[model samples]
Target chain A: MRETESAAEARPYHHGDLRRALIDAARRILETKGPAALSLRAVAREAGVSPAAPYHHFKDKGELLDAVADEGWRILNEAMKAAGENAPSPRAAMPSLGVAYVCFAREHPALYRVMYKRSRDKEALPEHLHEGEDSAYCRTRDTLIAAGADPSDPVGLELATIAAWCAAHGLAEIGGFQQFAHLKEALGGEEAFFRGVFEHMGVFARGLND
Target chain B: MRETESAAEARPYHHGDLRRALIDAARRILETKGPAALSLRAVAREAGVSPAAPYHHFKDKGELLDAVADEGWRILNEAMKAAGENAPSPRAAMPSLGVAYVCFAREHPALYRVMYKRSRDKEALPEHLHEGEDSAYCRTRDTLIAAGADPSDPVGLELATIAAWCAAHGLAEIGGFQQFAHLKEALGGEEAFFRGVFEHMGVFARGLND
Candidate 1:
């Protein structure tokens, strides 16, 4: 970034709003054109700012994308939180949150793809996503605990959290298949289809014949 | 296709072996150079075959990618089938298949991504993938029935199958999360980590405090 330090000093002011505007520009581009067309220069152009403006807020396109994905995760975390709060009971929060997650993905397909695909090559999910209280993963864990998973059993707890997260993630990806269209219609609609998947999110534990 | 009808006819012979070779070449390319580097011409070059020879089998890169994805799905289905068969009991096959699904994704991350991303623009999972006797999705349905989900209850059966599929899919996507590194180490090795996630694939029916 120091390579452009003279340009940065020319601005001589904080860019709190510029940072937000640049992210918004990247998102609009993601929605309209897709990820391939997104670049720092494009984002700057979209925000109606000078060519070097985006660099002031983000070192490069990767950093800018990370910010966009951070925004996406925040939105998802909020939705999951709301789902947990709105459920009829602590137990019900499990599937409600799952439903919320799938809905979030369906609503923001581009953002959803970016959020997950952001770290496709990274050794792990971006730390900010799973770390801290704002994390959507943490919300899942909280709901799992409220739903009776033992907090003391770290292995079981993490496994269960991964289970819930995966179920929701899987449905979000493949639940829209034509094979499931009839089932979705029979279940009443999109949300019902989500519920159907989640209600049975667990194995049939009893395995009737057993 | 008529545009190249004469060219295709120029080689009036069965390409059974050539088709297989082309697909093999594609796999090698995918593994070595990643998806962006995969093209029909590249496959031909890799196979040490003439560029036009690939044309006899694949009209374009998209068509070849579909074939590649088909191979991927077939491998996945077979793995799931093997897992189901190897499990001690039909009831155990449910999670066994889930474990197999994730294992397949882990082993073939590039193929796995191609398999799903192939239909990112389409209305559904590829028709052949979900349609025939060999489909991985069908395998999931069969495992659900074997585990005692009611065949008569179409909604319930499909829901169960979807839940299992999504859980596996989800884990395959996020299961390696660095957040779970310690948990994976504690659980044993990677396969054990897969099992831990699968073992708790279902929701906690009892809600301990209940």
Candidate 2:
């Protein structure tokens, strides 16, 4: 089996694959051994390449970590979009978007923490905050707009988006408390509790009776 | 001024005052030099005491940090109480409770981070989460109950409490972003912006039209 796959495996060290390979290796190290174990040399080792090989792609550990964080954002954005799209309606998508956001943070705690901690110093909204059509903020904003949130009042729309984002983020921050274990179970486990809270918050979600 | 205050300053080295003095010094160091610069030795120097003085109260840097964090919790609780009490109505107090929560995080970010980071490992709710009538959680819970949230449905009340807490925590997490400067100004300022978001989330706060 090893002999048959060797040819395909050898492609990892190729110029185009090395960066992606290194990032993938870094991600594994991040989840398995935690952030402290990550370094260019270690990533190179994990990628099964020569120690100097990572230098061709990432100039230093910071660059490699940045690449890893970028990957986290991409995946997180996709998760939010998928969760939103799976919802029955645009009105319901708001909570789904929040639930997915918190789920992403819970699933990849180290990567999630590192991702935002880096952006925090920038004193501006990170890329996920309404920068483009695919950005998480815009997705949330679009959902709210579809749900009959006022599109004309740009400031009102932004505050409403912040309200929803902050609710998800705040839940992620302390959602793991054992005190909530009973409530979470009672509410039909974590996702239900999240959707419940999101619905209860209901920035534009006026149809709880429905 | 020094000649008059020397006698009062002399009180800080007293047994009870020494511990408080050390925490105050640590707080100053935390804000000025950041967490990396903290050590029992550094705190002793900041407190203007013998290098060995901190040992009498705190056995290690960790103990000293725990003490500092305790002081932070006390201050945060007081802020929440004041905010809740100041609100004109029980319904409005929910947002007020959240506003003060975020304000505390903003005013003393380093201490606030240290406080919660230590609690994160416990996998349980922190002391402020409905442990007593004085705790922040109960204050929010009591406010909600006063405002018509069902006390008999303890689970419902608990979920509502969490929603409000997370909103505040999440805002504090990213409330410093410069992107909100214009909105903050348009809302009449930062506190107003916080109130708006909190009202928008409104957990059990359905009277947004009010």
Top DockQ prediction, candidate number: 1
Alpha-carbon shift of residue A104 in model 2 (angstroms) = 1.2
lDDT of 2 by residue, B131-152 (tens): 8888877877787777666679
- Candidate 2 backbone overlaps, count: 0
Q: What interface RMSD, in Å and to 1 decimal, does model 1 have?
A: 3.5
True contacts kept of 1: 0.61
lDDT of 2 by residue, A1-210 (tens): 345555655653255778898889888988998765777788888888889887778777667777788888889889987988898775566666778998898888778866765556454555555578888888877877776677897877777778777877778867876777877888887888876665555322221111
Looking at model 1, the pairs that clash are A202-B202, A202-B203, A203-B202
Runs of candidate 1 with Cα error greater than 4 angstroms are A1-19, A36-45, A48-59, A204-210, B1-22, B36-59, B204-210
Summarize candidate 1's per-residue lDDT along A61-136 as a digit string, tens digits. 7788888988898898899888878988987777778889999998888788888877675647777667777578
- Which candidate ranks first by TM-score, i.e. highest? 1
